[model samples]
Target: MDAIRIQTSAITRPSINLHTNPSGISFMKDKLLETDKSVFSVFGPNLGHYADDIIIVFKCEISPHPDANFSIQAATSFVSGNAFVLRPWLGKDPGSLDE
Candidate 1:
C-alpha cells in the first residue's frame, strides 16, 4: 500500500503541477496544430489526400497530451518520417529551395 501510494503521488504531482497546467494547455494545442500544418505544407498540394489521414490521426492523438515536449517530438518524428517516405514522388528534397 505504501509503495503504491508513493508511486501514484510521484506520477500525479509532476503531471498535475507541471505538465497539465491550464494556461500552457492552450499553447500546446496550438503548437501541435501549427506543426501539423507546417509539415503538411512541406508535402504540398499533390500529397494532400495522402497526408490528410496522417494529420488527422496525429492531431487526435497528440493534441491533448499534457507534456509539451513529448507532443512536439512525436509530431516532428511523425511528419519527418512521412515526408521522407513521400519525398521521391514529390519530386523534391525537403531541404531544397527550388520550386
Candidate 2:
C-alpha cells in the first residue's frame, strides 16, 4: 500500500513508476501497464473556494517478494502545492464507513 500526497489546484493527469531493488530492475511509466487485475479507490476532502490544500491517498498492493519501490509523476496543469510520497503506516486497522 502507498499514500501519495498531491496538493495542487490544477486538474492534471498522474503517472506511476515501479522499480525492483537488489536486481536494480525498474519499469518506466510507459513500460508498465495498468491492468484491471487490481482496482483502487481514492478518498479525500472536497475542495472548496477557501481550501488551500488537499490530500490524495492512493492504495495499492505491494509484492512480498521484497525490493519494490514506486514513484509518481504528474503532467503540467495547475501549479501550486508540492507532491510527495508518504511512508506506509503500520498498526491500527482503518475504519469502515461509507458516506
Candidate 3:
C-alpha cells in the first residue's frame, strides 16, 4: 500500500453544503447521482479536536476482470519547513491475494 498527503490551511472549511434543501436527503441524492463507478468517502479527526492536516486513503482497481485486484493508495498532508506538502500515490495493483 502507498500513502499520499495533502495539506491546506483551510482544513476546517466546509467542502459540501448538506443544507442545500429543507431536507438534507436531497443533497445526498444529487451527490450520489453524480458519482462515478468508483465510490469514496472522506474521513478526518474527531469533532471538537482537529488534526494539523488531513489524509484520505483509498484503493484503485487496475484490472477489468470480475475478480480484479486493487492497489492501495492514500492522500494526506504534512508540515514541512514553514510550509505544507501535498503528496499523492497511484501504484500498480499488487495482484490477487491468493498469489
TM-score of each: 0.28, 0.16, 0.16
Better of 1 and 3 by lDDT: 1
Model 3 lDDT per residue over 1-99, tens place: 122223332332334332232322233433333322333333543342332234655455434557653323221111111112222232333343222
Model 1 steric clash total: 0
Lowest summed-lDDT stretch of 10 residues in model 1? 36-45
Model 1 root mean square deviation, Cα atoms: 12.6
Clashes of each: 0, 0, 5
Q: Report, for every candidate in turn, its global Cα lDDT versus the true structure.
A: 0.44, 0.27, 0.31
Candidate 2 on 1-99: residue-level lDDT in tens? Answer: 123334331223221222222111222321223322222222444333422344544345553335543333221000111222222232232332110
Those runs of model 2 whose alpha carbons end farther than 4 Å from true positions after fitting are 1-35, 46-99
| CA RMSD per model (angstroms) | 12.6, 18.4, 17.2
- On residues 16-67, what C-alpha lDDT tens digit does candidate 1 reach at each position? 8644543322334436545423333232234324232332234666656775
Off by over 4 Å in 1: 17-82, 85-87, 94-99
- Ten residues in sequence with the least summed lDDT for candidate 2: 73-82
Candidate 3 local accuracy as lDDT? 0.31
Error of model 2, residue 48, in angstroms? 14
Candidate 1's error at 82, in angstroms?
8.6
